[model samples]
Target: MGTLVSLGSFCLVRFAVRLLLLMFRGAEASTFTFVNKCGQTVWPGILSNAGSPALESTGFELPAASSRAFQPPTGWSGRFWARTGCSAAASGGAWSCATGDCGSGQVECNGAGAAPPATLAEFTLAPSSAGQDFYDVSLVDGYNLPMVVEASGTPGAGGSCAATGCVVDLNRMCPAELRVAEGGACRSACEAFGTPEFCCSGAYASPATCRPSTYSQMFKSACPKSYSYAFDDPTSTFTCAGGADYTITFCPGSAPSQKSSRDSSTSSTTTASSTYSGTGGGLTLEDDSWLASLATGDASHATTARGPVPFLYSFIAAMALAYTLLQ
Candidate 1:
């Protein structure tokens, strides 16, 4: 049974990655710098698209007021989100996070994606066909921390570039029903309700049907440039003019002179309880060597899958497929 599950995962992931590449062709090579400016430490998780190769390290520790830089090969499309209140895994040297846990029970998520109700910074760089990079800070999954993506430097030739993200901390204003992780993160209405209206499933899957709700509007009001809903691409998705490299910062207000209204209000913060915690070092590394083997050519890494995907991706993918077909 485990073998069958792994086989299915391999096929599904491979198909998904291929479709992503075709959808975002002309992607260019780029380097990303993930910086942690939050007052507390966070474990950052990385997950590439199904067919895409994995990054150098799937997960790692980023202490408060620190940063790390890594390069994703051309055509890579995936997400980066922080996990807070992590404790080291008992046997694997892995860290389990209170929020944004990837279910790998390790620092490296391997090929696994993040759990929902976590702020996500997503990227699709250098889409060859469009000749641009598309990126956005998404609150559609919900919010845990403040974040922003800045693209500096000139665009190549005729390309254009700009910065876009939700620099405001939404947790302070998150609706009571949508609050999760003891208010450390905000859960999207869809995640909380799981109905057709909130999840945009079944009949509500189409863009025309799944219009923005009052809750999404609240998020938009707080961060106009960020994605408040799944179909907010027209307003939320930003192009980097010429596929420029980017700096993704947690707590954008931590930067000089960027303090937002949310940052200034009261300013008292609380730490949530975590099931696990771990410092950096002495952890078992998941076997991600398959990434390099598959990177050499256009081939799928068809090994036995390790675990079922975290529920977040499965839900999002289903909704996305419904939206596409209904549209």
Candidate 2:
């Protein structure tokens, strides 16, 4: 009788453990971590495997689990404007970033020829320019497609810009843009090769001037000064390489590419990085592995180890004691 009770207790305990495991399910998909070269996290623009990459949208979905994956050109250029300080009623959207104001902000949308502030997300296969006046770089449109990251300027209080007129700096705190001076001046960037200016009502902020052509032939002559990541040689900037488009995704400690400092005169690829920052805070991504480990895979042997089954043993002992007394 004693031996039978012991054996039954052991088997019952094992069954209970197995049942618990089945009820909880073993692991999950959160354990994996993926990186997108496209520079954006919402995958629809660059990572979606099913949608037409040539279309534009806010985000995308991954075809499968991947790590360090660049944003595949889905079509959206990964560019959107957040109205800066405008009430929803006034800006008509979240922020009037397209207009440059937050509330009651307005932009002087001149005729069809008015200039708009464009975010340089990627370059497409296009011809180069000879000067800084006008230039073009094919861009990756949403739907993972092609478009142009054109550059031009205007001379008005604020043409079609969100709030009158101003150029919003995208390259902030990254080692890249920091290589130049700050504030109302054409300190660094592809514009310096020409006349570092801001796109205000009549001239670029740096006193250089703005036009609506989109291409800056200024680099070839100014290539000696500052080169466009799209027009320059390979490894020009983080998102300026020649072949594929880059979508941006923000993650913790994931901003290794934020460095923008390089020596233009030396032409030496290896140069110290000058810290520069503009606005979109450094990329901070969530830990995917945390989710993945919980979804699948076997637990470590140490984890599977069974602790003393005190409750089970106690119950068995009680049963035995009752039997002895009754007998």
Cα displacement (Å) at residue 79, model 1: 0.8
- For residue 299, give model 2's deviation from the true position in Å: 35
TM-scores, one per candidate:
0.66, 0.23
Best by lDDT: 1
Candidates' C-alpha lDDT: 0.65, 0.24
Name the runs in model 1 displaced over 4 angstroms: 1-28, 89-94, 127-130, 153-160, 241-243, 254-327
For 1-327, candidate 1 gives per-residue lDDT tens digits of 989867776666666667665434323345576666666788888888877788899998887666677767766788999888899767777668888899897788887878888888888866442466777789889887766665543444543344566655567677789988887788998998888887788999899999899999898877776788878887667665433456676664322222221222222222222211122111111233322221121113311111232334655676486455433
> Model 2: runs farther than 4 Å from truth?
1-53, 56-95, 98-119, 123-230, 237-247, 255-327
The TM-score of candidate 1 is 0.66
User: Looking at model 1, which ten-residue stretch has the lowest summed lDDT?
Assistant: 275-284
Instruction: Give the 10-residue window scoring lowest on summed lDDT in candidate 2.
Output: 139-148
Tell me the tens digit of each residue's lDDT in model 2 across 2-73: 998788767666665565554333110001112222222222222122322432323223221122322222
In angstroms, give how far residue 106 of model 2 lies from its true place. Answer: 14
lDDT of residue 86 for candidate 2: 22
